[model samples]
Target: MSFELRRATVEDLSFARELTSQNMLRYYIEFELPWQDHAFDVAWSERQNWLIVRDSVPVGYVSLSRDMRALYIRELQVAEAFHRQGAGSWAIDQVIDIARGERRPAIRLTVFENNPARSLYERKGLQVQGRDECFLRMQLDISTPVL
Candidate 1:
């Protein structure tokens, strides 16, 4: 699906919340207790945020926080139906591009332990930086993904 991403507005919150949580569940391949609010709160407290769209309809979401030299990506999620459709990659590309434009040091994000995207991140050169009960923080070198 063709789509575009703009800076998220307050109106995007409702949509972002759902997409973010649902994506977490899907990424982990679990839900029962994994989708709990506790999971989101951890990311939210970091001050990162996002909302993505496809063909004029919201299709994905994320949350990000920037510190001294790092772009902390809290969450990134595309609707289950949108998997392999480029929605998630599109959103991630935008974030990296924007960060590069700003000369950010590195990009960071926390993904569920079982998330398949970890492989994508590995190919993209994002290395494990830390971990929590629900997330494995990955860091990408801003100088170049190949570094």
Candidate 2:
């Protein structure tokens, strides 16, 4: 399957937000966290977002941002029908490439402690750097040369 990423615009907000809510709502409820629509709306407007397209159809979206030190993955969500087909991994690889291209030292993200996606992030080379009550902070130190 050939995957392409297209920049997300205002027109894509509903799809992206719904996809994220579908994928994350369980975790939010399980962790006793509030699902804030306004916050997601603000992020959609602020972040660098992309839709993961396969055969011209969108299968998911990824939201990203960066600082001087690292690239941050704010959201990564694949439609349930498309899970296990490698879209998520492909997105992560793309994010890594973007970080490397920009000369960022690392990639960072936070995942709910029990979220299954944590294993996928681990497989892509992000290690848990710390944890609080509800989230695990993970980072991939790309500054180190890959052997």
- Against the true structure, what is each candidate's TM-score? 0.77, 0.96
Predicted model with the maximum lDDT: 2
Candidate whose TM-score is highest: 2
Off by over 4 Å in 2: 144-147
Look at candidate 2 and give me any clashing residue pairs.
Answer: none
Candidate 2 lDDT, 1-147, residue by residue in tens: 789999998999999989999999998899889999889999899899999999999999999999998999999999999999999999999999999889899999999999999999999999999998999999999874666
| Model 2: lowest-lDDT 10 consecutive positions | 138-147
Cα shift from native, residue 87, model 2 (Å): 0.3
lDDT by residue (1-147, candidate 1, tens digit) is 577866676566667667665655555455245456665555465565656777777778767788777887777778888888877777778888878877788998877778798887777778998988777889987874543
All models: lDDT?
0.73, 0.94
